[model samples]
Target: MNRSSECITKDSSRLITTELKPPDISLVQEKSWNAAVQMFGSFLLAGFGMVAASLVLDVVQHWPVYEQVSEVYILVPALLGLKGNLEMTLASRLSTHAHLGHLENCLSTITLGNLCLVQCQAILVGFLAAMAAVAMGWIPSGEFDIHHAMLLCASSVLTASVASFVLGVIMIGVIVISKKLNINPDNIATPIAASLGDLTTLALLSWIATLLYRSIGTNILLPAIIIIIGAVLVPVCGYAAWKNKFTKQALDEGWVPVVSAMVISSAGGLILDFTVSNYKGIAVFQLVINGIGGNMAAVHASRLSTTLHTGQLEGPVISATTKLLLLMVVPGQLVFIYTIGYLKAGHTSLTPIFMLIYLSAALLQVFLLLIISHYMVVWMWKLGIDPDNSAIPYLTALGDLLGTALLGVAFHILYAIGDKDSDLGD
Candidate 1:
């Protein structure tokens, strides 16, 4: 009887261990799988969105307004970068709030205040970008006409304001819905912000600039009037955002990143302005590549910000989430590259060498961006600065700069190789 009891006790202990182990492993695997799906879906959606936005940019570049106003080309990268900064930062902020349970109500003071803050910043940055573009354009060409200046300022301010309002609202809905559906907003919000940001801002800038351009000589007052309205709305939005507690800190300390990002992006704009004309399809591919890099970095930043907000200090340097994000880049970019080839097939061919170089450039851009996002978010948190407010702008701007510079190098290399090939053939 004693031997039988001993064997039964051992068997029970073994059963318990076996039962507990599988469930634990299953739970972990389930979580990792869900995260992968969330991130992959977001990236796929963002990739397609950028493909369409790049096409729009290519189309707009041929428009009379874009060609006539050289400053407009200089303004495009800056304005689009600023739009991404504002909306993605807004998304990151909201995602953090959602993860912390502060975003349970869509009409909450926190949500509304954050939205208002983006609007105010958009107004201020929009006008500043226009001024910077004008200066950049002037330094290179030594030509500054008041008519062109007014048109750029009006277009920038109006596009920024309208895009901010629309994108801000969309961000709120996205976050709220994600929360309701038991989805992680951090996984989806930033990419959507980037995806829609390029399309909406470029479309608005194109339409508004064309309309304003038409009225330049006949009614010079139109541009001036739009600028005045944008200026007036700044104070209104500021007042609204300031009355709430959740966003007051951001409003006080957020200008550095946003303004600095705009400057960095303007530098990229200058690069684009110089190199785009010489290259066959740089404009189309540049927007797509830049947006992809920024979107991936923003995803990493947004996820890290949420983790940091939840009080996890010593997290893994390269989490499964980061790996998933980095992995998505290759396939996502391959699709965009070939899509560009198909779209611009008449103008430019996607040779194997060019595609390989472009892919390498994109991979390098995203890999560096991921590393930066990881360190920047942690560093900002240690400094008592909110990563959600600070990291996305800088990361996205850096993405824009890296994407443009690397793309320029790739084209230059291709050109040299082509020249050599022609000589060899001769």
Candidate 2:
């Protein structure tokens, strides 16, 4: 038995050696270091930017439609933050090189084409969702006319889409840098991209709002119409891109992501709008879909593609999977927090912000508990452990806390801000 066990150990060690890819020491030293700095800086800026935008928007919401409102400052972060969770979807995939296969190339045409299509599709989906909110009255009709609302919606789509597109390009570039430096894009891309998207999207959203209010006569009627137009056109544009020769293959290759993202985004808006119209308050109702779907695992497949310089096939899978999983975990958990806060203080906003504040006092609460699980999988991989061996399921179950903690922290922060404002008033 001892001799048999020794033989088995020898075989296992050999298998591990055969599967491992050698590290690129020089690449890690040069390119990776730079990328890390930029990525970290970007994350901090985004976080601060979001806080600023939220405050600005809160102020804008108080103004009268067509009342010469000048709170355009909020536009900055609102644009970036609007699609906070989504921008990472494509950025990570393209950088990771998941396109050709689980193990593939990065600079390939297939990868680029797919990035274009997915980005466009995501934009359309976002538009549809935003519009559906307006259509169903989930997003309160501004104290203005339908035309102004339409304008806001239209501008929102263009701003969000354009910003998302630019960010995708930058994210891919950074991931490529990570790959060139022999670092795994997966490790760096998601967090950085997520933060950037949040910052840039929110900022842009606020800018669009300001611009629309100025040139469109501030009637508020146009924002809704604009949103409807955007919701209609964004997907059509994506479909058109699909028919383009370069992306035709990508379109075929990534049909499911394009279709599904559009559907879900649109559906979510409609559903949330329904809830809002019926309930009648400033509830963080978007969770009915987005929060639930956030935790799905694309797990750097597409990012791996870009890092490996591979194909489009990997990105959408990761995007779709991550979105699905996150939806299930985030919404349900945050809703609980929102309910708790409302019951206690009788005010509401996005639930995630409230939960985040729970962190300030209770370090090991539900939200904080998730951090261990979220990071463990990440930590295990750093130790060269493959999740396929045993940890995947446990890690995923544990990941439920990532969203919970994030939402908790978010909820807590927002609630605290509101409280501060109340105190000032009192």
Candidate 3:
């Protein structure tokens, strides 16, 4: 009986040990880690590119056109945000095409159709964003002049037309390259496109704005002619796109998202309008923060949408892939915030309170983006809509709005904390 009891006790102990042992990592989890690592690495590389490109903003700040037309500052983020919106949509469409085996050739009908659609959207939205920027500038500054509006509109349209064509081609190339390498374009394309979009848009906007400012000096006819040409070109492109069935489908899938993004982007500009004075010389940092946040959210939205479409992810629960993505955000936000802060403001300006406020705002931005992407993708899927068609644009737009608002809040919080600290010291 004692021997029998010993055998049972030993068996029970063995069972306990087995139960306590960690399970081998599943294939799904392994894939999630691999995907996360690949995406995080790509984002880091793209981010460095954006940082280098953003130095152009310092040059822009020194430009006479920028200084003379402060409204251009407000227009900057809106224009870049719109560029990102269109390119992000293109990336999503390409990613979906890749997954569906339609990306076998760059010159495929679907690819051409989508390209035409994006270009048309770019022309229309660029013109409108510029006109809106003029109005936004007029609201507070009350410096509404037809020549100034025409110059701004002309600058926006010309820059956008060129940038969209170039960036769209680059994104298609990225999709092809990612496919050849067996990497997910969805993971890499949107962020890279966004970074490139910001850089190229800013550079082009500055060059075109300065050139227009000089060329049309007190000449209403030249500016008026340019604006008229821009206005006429929009409907012509739209009509052409509408006539093509495939392009029409692409436009149908893309326009609402674009309009929604514009609304959200305008809100971001409004936030900048209200809070930029508080930060004084550091207004350029807003572009960096918005670009980074928007890029991160775009990556997440693109990946999540792809996974959802592929049946690899379901519902709104955070997957291992998402957890790994979120883990990447923590260090990335810290590095960007600290590095840019030091470079722009100074190391001494990065006080603990400032760090805390910045980190909190950034982390909160990422967190909100993740949650928003998850739910938005799931809801679209349930509605029989393609999340790829809508998710990235919405996420990016929301990222801009949220990033701006959060930064404003962070600034206020830091000021209050500093005041409290000074009182204590006194």
Question: Evaluated with TM-score, which candidate comes out highest?
Answer: 1
lDDT of 3 at 350: 54
TM-score per prediction, in order, is: 0.84, 0.48, 0.82
Report the C-alpha lDDT of model 3 over 122-143, residue by residue, as the tens digit: 8778887887789888988766
307-418 per-residue lDDT for model 1 (tens digits): 6665555368777777887788788888777776666532446677877887888888888889888999888877878888888889988998899999888878877788
Could you tell me which residue pairs clash in candidate 3?
A: none
Candidate 2 lDDT at 70 equals: 25
| Residue 254 shift from truth in candidate 2, angstroms | 7.4
- After superposition, candidate 1 runs with Cα above 4 Å error: 1-30, 140-143, 266-283, 345-356, 408-426
Q: How far off is residue 307 in model 3, in Å?
A: 2.8
- Rate residue 124 of model 1 by lDDT: 91
> lDDT per prediction?
0.79, 0.42, 0.70
Question: Cα deviation of 298 in candidate 1 (Å)?
Answer: 0.6
1 or 2, greater by TM-score: 1
TM-score for predicted model 2 compared with the true structure: 0.48
Per-candidate total of colliding backbone pairs: 0, 99, 0
Stretches of candidate 2 exceeding 4 Å from the true structure: 1-82, 98-112, 136-144, 217-426
For model 3, what is the C-alpha lDDT against the true structure?
0.70
| Tens-place lDDT digits, model 2, residues 331-403 | 4344444553454433344344334543332223323323333454345444544322222223222333343
Error of 2 at 17 (Å): 24
